[model samples]
Target: MAKQRIGIYPGTFDPITNGHLDIIKRGLRLVDKLVIGVATNPSKDPMFSLSERVAVVERETHDMAKVAGVEIDVMPFDELLMKFAERVGADIIIRGLRAVADFEYEFQMTGMNYQINPNIETVFLMADPRYQTIASRLVKEVARYDGNIEAFVPSMVASEVVKRVNESKV
Candidate 1:
């Protein structure tokens, strides 16, 4: 029997934009199981707490997982990405590239990760043109200004972002 191919898609997922979902959907096609690693990245000044982000990710991905028939697991991590990947026994690390700017940073990280563990391979998926510019940071910025974010994030997440932004104002 063939071994189950497990892949890990790690990101801050501050508010999981459509671009992130695009990657997850495509990544699911390449692996039997996917572990969505929610990074505890304090550097990003996340609009949502770790638990909130996890909940949003889980909610947004539930239907996709079912439809794709791919097992999906969402978990929080606060350590090196490679270590987290190792802990999850992931042989593939899935990433999404939006532009050349992203490629430089990802290139460096991929090299560093390879040095740490050459056994695990990194796979890059180009973001769909429609979602190429939908980033969590930009989405949050729009939400902070009371601008529409429904186009960038899932409907439920858009509501959550608006609610969180309003609460932050109080």
Candidate 2:
């Protein structure tokens, strides 16, 4: 049988972190093609716009040769995630699980996506221990208090966060 043509990894990626990159890197190894989907959420306020987030992600992964064959795409969707996966021509969906909390939510999503498209499978990758507790919300919270997020996010995004926070104060 031929290998799957494409795999989709979707996330809000408010500020892409090393954890996310880890999954992206690993997921690349398991499929012929990998697409990083930057989901748009209009219901909640996001610190950075979709365009900004896309640029930050693109910059961060620009020099990654391991996944050089992988392509990154930004998506703005208010519909079901399975539809998004199908739209991207992906046969597999990549998800990163940080903890039990994430498992519960991911489990439900996986089932729903399966129902939507049985051919599309959700693959869950465990987050490294070092990043198990890291999340975009926490990163922003720490930055809000003027804490360094250098370790949480990519350098490009870290600088972006600093710029956004500083601009918000004035």
Q: For model 2, how big is the CA root-mean-square deviation?
A: 1.8
Q: Cα lDDT of all candidates, in order?
A: 0.95, 0.82
Off by over 4 Å in 2: 1-4, 65-68, 74-78
Could you tell me the TM-score of candidate 2?
A: 0.92
Q: Quick one: how many clashes does candidate 1 have?
A: 0
| Residues 23-134 of candidate 2: C-alpha lDDT, one tens digit per residue | 8888777777777788788665789998888887777766663446755554555567787778778888999999999999999888877787999988999998988889
Q: Which candidate's TM-score is highest?
A: 1
Q: Positional deviation of 147 in candidate 1, in angstroms?
A: 0.8
Top candidate by lDDT:
1
Please provide TM-scores, in order, for all candidate models, with all chains considered together.
Answer: 0.98, 0.92
Per-residue error at 71 for model 1, in Å? 0.4
Which tens-of-lDDT digit does each residue in 1-170 have in candidate 1?
Answer: 99999999999998998999999999999999999999999999988889998998999999999999999999999999999999989999999999999999999999999999999999999999999888899999999999999999989889989999999999
Cα lDDT of candidate 1 equals 0.95
